[model samples]
Target: MHKGNFKEMYLNTEQLDLGKFKVATSETLYMTVVSMLFVIIIGLILGLLLYNLGKSKRIGAKIFYNLLSIISNICRSVPFIILIILLIPFTKALMGTFLGAKAAIPSLVISAAPFYGRLVEMAFREVDHGVLEAANSMGANKWELVTKVLIPESLPALISGVTVTVITMIGFTAMAGAIGAGGLGGLAYQEGFMRNRPTITLFATICVLVIVFMVQWLGDWAVKKTDKR
Candidate 1:
């Protein structure tokens, strides 16, 4: 593996930012959690709508579903770095500054939401068709079908998707640091690559890895709990 030319020299440990470890961990967590809330909420709504509309026989519902599908595809297709740059103005407008933890949330959601939205749709699709037919035969209303049948049935899949989306966001959070977003990635960029302090950079990376491991462990537990089948 290429360790890069800078690794040949000793790092200046004194140049490390002492607060970086805490800031990196905090920023990454904050951005990941906050953005995930929005992603799950919006993704759920969009997923349900997409599924219902596509199932409907009405021409208008079909049109709306097609439009929504197109939009989700476009959002998912955009790269995270470009999406963050494009949303910088909006983030600044909303949070008054797009440089820190809060500023990074907007981009993180844009990058994760559509991805999770599709996951939600796929999860919902996995529900047994016989169950949906039974619910409908019993005159279950739209809300009942969605709340009782769709969501509950797909909970396990949603749990798994949440894990994947959150992990992806953590990586994006690091990339956001490249643009002064103030996370472990940013700390690594500044100390490891820019300052050429390899030790500080390596430490910041390990911190990220540990956090990812914890998240994965918890997510796996949740999936196991939710998956009765």
Candidate 2:
């Protein structure tokens, strides 16, 4: 292996455009934020629905739970690269081309929604049954029990779950870059892997690490701040 020169690599500026960095970073951030919003909305609703299913005796809560469990398991089990390719046709059709950040959004949303849905389900499950019963005793409707009691009580866990989802989306975004989406990953691949620029690759790697760590730290602090226990 040819060793990369750290000093030369750090000092080089041939391909280091701060503006492009800003643009790429902005696109990546937008993708993460927007996709996460969709994930939370879809996941939370599905999770609450599943939680209600588990509570009801109508169609055998056990069976409903098992079916959802299986579907979630299938989605979570697929490798991301394969998943991206699997969605390529749909992505191109939906966005007019599967060649950039916009193209990547569909796959990101598809993959993220199911993952966070399972996490949200777990978060909902963690809510105390007594609290739910008390809410019901006070004449709380299903929506009231969900929004007022279940979601509020699970806020800390939900934040933590969002943290996990963000970190995972960072990875997915990187993978999406390999498919022609222009982000740090795509930048790294173009400048480093394909063009033999070790400096760019190293910088991209460090930036991703920093972003992921900062997200986790912020998440931890938020959870701690909100936790009453």
State every prediction's TM-score relative to the real structure.
0.90, 0.92
Q: How would you encode candidate 2's per-residue C-alpha lDDT over 1-229 as one tens digit per residue?
A: 2245656655467857778667767767877888889988988877776777877787678798779878877777788778889988898888999888888888887788888887888898998899999999999998898778888899999899999999999888888887788788887787677887777777787778888999999999999987879
lDDT (tens digit, per residue) of candidate 1 on 135-191: 999999989999899899999999999999888889999999899898898888976
What's the distance in Å from true for residue 105, model 2? 1.0
In terms of lDDT, the best-performing candidate is: 1
Q: Return the number of clashes found in candidate 2.
A: 0
Which parts of model 1 are misplaced by more than 4 Å? 1-18
lDDT of each: 0.87, 0.83
Model 2 TM-score is 0.92
